[model samples]
Target chain A: MDFRKKLAIEPGSTVSLADINPEQDGGIESKEEGKEKLSGILDEITPLQEMLYAEKKHALLIVLQGIDAAGKDGVCWHVIRAMNPQGTYVASFKQPTEVEKAHDFLWRVHQRVPAMGQVAVFNRSHYEDVLVARVHNLVSKQVWSKRYHEINNFEEFLTENGVTIVKFFLYISKDEQLERFEKRLEDKDRQWKISASDYAERDRWDEYIEAYEAMLSHCSTAHAPWYVIPANRKWFRNLAAADIIHRAMLDMQIESPRPTVDIDEIYRRYHHAVREA
Target chain B: MDFRKKLAIEPGSTVSLADINPEQDGGIESKEEGKEKLSGILDEITPLQEMLYAEKKHALLIVLQGIDAAGKDGVCWHVIRAMNPQGTYVASFKQPTEVEKAHDFLWRVHQRVPAMGQVAVFNRSHYEDVLVARVHNLVSKQVWSKRYHEINNFEEFLTENGVTIVKFFLYISKDEQLERFEKRLEDKDRQWKISASDYAERDRWDEYIEAYEAMLSHCSTAHAPWYVIPANRKWFRNLAAADIIHRAMLDMQIESPRPTVDIDEIYRRYHHAVREA
Candidate 1:
């Protein structure tokens, strides 16, 4: 299936993680085949990103989110490795600093959005106001519920100001997660990835799913859409993501900017003086 | 002379524009020699900036201020051309947008300070509060005068968070500015840069000088010292600015971060999986 057609959450449609298979391989027959397709997609993305940077007229924001071990980092690393580091920016949201906490929730996120002709990837973004903030009773239900509309309006404002937003929810099943956790235990280099809270959070998986379902339903607008990528197979997850991002760039109709200066006139005027200098 | 030592405004000392000659060209004997030294400085800056971005621990903010055609843009353009575009950020302060005017004067400037492991250049910075606001009587004397201390404290807070601040006041005489404006009128490519307001602002040169002198004297502190650069000659301005910027980066003592993951162990665990994929 074309992942863009299959994966985009239609506006007002309810989404359930249980109905979506985490094991789907995006129609690629094998891991090797998927990797090859992903590499091809990467080659396509690099030049489009260069055009986006050179044009200096539009901004692209990619928001990555997932539960623990859901491949957010893996997808960001694999996919963005294709683009020039000069034009690609990554802002990983951690626990809010005291200064950030003093401002409104979107304050930090808004400040870090891609400037004109730039691409900024948010490791976790304003959606966390709905996810972790909602899940932990950090605020009242009414407050979290109101944030969906606020986020939609804020994103609309950004789009009006030339930012294009793409969001991804990496969907991994509990069984697959346990298998990855087991691997983490056995691999010395990966042990740092394990935390007691990872298991604690895993136990609350159903609650998170309900929260994600509401988020996917409420905030998935035409201007900024969310893609639900199957994450049990890491290679397939990266491939499908690469395909969606490439399609979004194609949708943007990106063209490089025309030269600002009249080069011939400049040469005509300054040619003799330049040689003396 | 070391540009850092020569240019820094000694705190608590009264400043007089008459005491300094804007036409003075550091100690460089010739423009060609200055340009060669600038190229060498740029070569030194590129690697240091790379180490800074990799280190992800410190931030540098360079603030430029001057009258019209004092070469704020020139200094920023020439100095920053040496650094990696990925790691260098430029925030040019134009007339305040409505939203910016709604908040405290420093609100927009504080938002644009450098983040960790980044170099942020402010083409015109918060110093405008002292200069333009004071010159035009935009704010009450009580309000604008009190902001100098507030700004000093705000900058200190940034320093405590691992930021190094450098401020430059590009000092050029009224005669030099008029000559430059005349040149702008002659050059078709530069005509867009000239405005009726440029001439109007030129009439207030002495008021601007007094304002700048006060700003240099009152706000120049040991931590984030101000440099009053004699900027009549473009070549000398670029070289002296580059020298001071290099000195600031050197003081940062930036070093690349150590590897986070154990390479040998990652090799041991992931080698087989990598081969299969």
Candidate 2:
């Protein structure tokens, strides 16, 4: 199945969280089968990512947005990890400090956009201003409402400059979130991830959903589209994200530039250096 | 005197290198007077630069392009040194490395553009693509010719995003360049800067002048204007550049953001912490 087509929120189309299944398996029978498919997708991503670095013709920016326990971190570890770390960077946006809040919302975001020949995965991004900032009333409606158009313009500018942007909105149900929270509580290694605000934020789930829906409806564009990935199932989430990324990279059709120097002259010089040694 | 108006290349207007005097000093009587004026300009810049960093509202990008031995580095050391080191960066563009050559000409340049609240000075910039590359026939006419429009669009985008761009073309005569080369040879401290290609490049001075004139005519826009400084007089060059930069930054009118937290509440909390201690 073409996961990109299956998951992408079409430009100018509104998305309803209730309509999409959080438990989607993409026709895979079981956990073992899903893991195998995910491995295959990761394998496909590795070589394409190398070509992306070698060709240096295009940059790829992957934006991940989700509520707590929706597997944003899991996707980064399992899916984006396929790319070489040398050319891959992950920028996680948490609460803004005084310095970040002083500038326009996109100020910090633009600084982290990928350079050519690289991939950048935004753990949370400029969308947070429209998401958390909107839901929490951190900024006035006048300010946050204007950002959708600003974001569209910014993304279009980046696209025109050879950055291919893919955004993922990880979808998970409240029950699944609770389950993950419970699992975190049981595991000592995951205990650090649990915060008192996690439970407090869960109470405002409906408001966050409304904000996410508005973001999807207004900001998705042909140049930088949003994807709603059913992320309750970890294996399926990894498989879907990797598959879409690999397809997007393949679409770039990056080719290494033709060598600009005279190969024969370099060969002769190398032999001379070897003789001197 | 409005040095910005006097020095700026008007958009869409062609320029002639021969018509402009590189020895013009804006009526400064001597090197000592010019140095005193430059010091005053630096004093004005220090406070404004501090406000820019505190406000975090805008970025400043200064591009310096010139022929070899034309005092680009001197301007960086003497003029730009007035700004605080914490908020200032200087990126010197040398010949492209193999990795850099694989990407578009602007890719390496865009990576070094200032972040919000910062100042970035490009010692020699993307103009090299059109100047050196065009003069030497490194790229075809079809390729180099299109870059003027590309550069304009790129600068316009940066300006719209709150980056103020100011480009300088340090103007010097052929005879002045030869004199500087002789001075460098006599000064042991400057001997490291002397290279054989500096003299060889002087032979193609006419071609380089044509390329620079074309660059000034085609790329200068209202948002990112180019200034041709009279660099034959080194002290005058420093004074002119500093004066222009101070004016441009003053125009930004950057104000520190309002305190986000309540001072009274912070004061109470501070007292409570002191009592507990």
Candidate 3:
């Protein structure tokens, strides 16, 4: 079996949130290496992080899409944890409101786009239009199919206008998902987390996968290429995501915008303001 | 003179962000205390936050408005800094986009409201429709005058549906503001922060204050009372605001939602998941 297949077994042929840990499993050595690599990456990007804040020039949007139990929240929480809180923002797009449905598909997503100095994370993201909507027949096949092109164009506009996009697709198997769902049922605290709707969604897993694969094939682009992460191994998933984000920040040359004044000038201004006061 | 007045005497009278000592400044005793208090507040309302999350209940809309350099950003940075990062969001409104101007006054503001268990902050808020837009003649007296009732009703709708609206007007004296503005101009690093437009805004100080007074009188209801913070002193501002939020969270009774099963059951689930893996 390949590394992905071996890691898949780590979750016990079941996909549970509790099962996804990097340190205890010892299955994904790459995760350990990824954590160490993060420190170095952070050092280089620290300046860029500062510049991004100072200049307030570009907003970054990261979109995470995956199968049920695909670890979207876990990856997001761990991946961008290293960033300066002031410079990062996370927006999870949930089920649409009455107001949201009245607008175009991109309306709600656009309002939460991080400012130039901010990094924004979209958990689940616009892909739902294709994934969920496609699988459930929530919208006509024609209506949902048109969204892929619309999404690409929307991302292209954001990228051209200084928004950097990083998209990730957390890939997990159906067997693994069933194991996770059963675990959720069995665990009391976690029992609250499961819903009948989740099972209803799970029943259509194959259709969802087809929708996702089609999304990956169509929407992945140079400006915001979608990284298909084998998320069966929780540790590897987290480590891989952190590495991808760290590299993206570096690749973008993220830096603090330089203020017009230096420390000395600031000191002078303080004194003058104090003296005048 | 009060400490606020005394502090206002010194132009650019602010401590370094790094050097801020809450205890010495008579705010909270220490950063840890601040953290504890914040966590306590979160713990108290966590249940509500979760319910909001589960039900995807009302969207929260917090409005922060103040004079030039009156610590709107500072309050935003710290108040939200302590929030559960996943559930808290901040939106700083700048010049309106062409698309935004094409819509009604609440168009942009409404779009950014936090969905269920989340906190959404408006750094400048929709009061601008009456305050800045009124002062600048961006909107007519009739247009701006009508916004107060509209805003009250808008807030009423949010509150009626479970959204808690907290509005704060950071109150800073003209002398204090002049001090801050002058400091910004003299400090090379901060010089870029002050634009020609900021000075233009300063010229209409009285008009802005008048607009604010009208707004405060009209909109400060029991449900969404506006707290006029003494903001010349940054430490006090942070502390006072923290106290207010803590109180509000207590009122809301935030707490982590209880699991359906007992603690032992959860432990068993954890153990079982591990064993099965």
Clash number for each model: 0, 0, 24
User: On residues A1-277, what C-alpha lDDT tens digit does candidate 1 reach at each position?
Assistant: 5788899999889887789999999677899999999999999998898778777788889989888889887776678756665466677787789999898899999889998888888888999999989998989999999999999999999999999898999999988887787676555445555556676688889999999999999999999998899899999999999999898899888875553444344334433233122
Name model 2 segments beyond 4 Å from true.
Answer: A1-277, B271-277
Q: TM-scores for all candidates?
A: 0.57, 0.51, 0.68
Task: State the displacement of the C-alpha of residue A250, model 3, in Å, after optimal TM-score superposition.
Answer: 3.0
Cα lDDT tens digits for candidate 2, B1-277: 6789899999989999899999999987888988998899999897788668667799999999998888997787677767655466677798999999999999999998988888889988999999999999999999999999999999999999999999999999998987786665544344445555675688899999999999999988999999999899999889889989999999998775554443334324422322111
Q: Which candidate wins on lDDT?
A: 2
Q: Is the docking of candidate 1 incorrect, acceptable, medium or high quality?
A: incorrect
Instruction: Compose the digit string of candidate 2's lDDT tens values, residues A49-125.
Output: 76687667899999999999898877876787666554666777879889999998889999989989889888889
DockQ-based ranking: 3, 1, 2
User: TM-score of chain B only, all predictions?
Assistant: 0.94, 0.95, 0.77
Candidate 3 stretches greater than 4 Å from native: A1-50, A53-57, A76-118, A129-158, A172-190, A203-219, A230-239, A254-277, B1-48, B82-87, B96-118, B134-150, B172-191, B199-214, B232-236, B253-277
What tens digits encode model 3's per-residue C-alpha lDDT throughout A93-195?
A: 8899999999988999988787687888898788898888888898998899899889989988899988888787777777677677667666543556665
Looking at model 2, the pairs that clash are none
- What is the i-RMS of every prediction? 9.3, 15.1, 6.0
lDDT per model vs. reference: 0.83, 0.84, 0.66
How far in Å is the alpha carbon of A134 misplaced in model 1? 21
Model 1, residue B185: distance off in Å is: 2.7
Please give, for residues B111-225, the per-residue lDDT of candidate 1 as tens digits: 8888898888888889899889999999999999998899899888899999999999998888788778667655544555555667668778889989998999988988899
How much lDDT does candidate 1 score?
Answer: 0.83
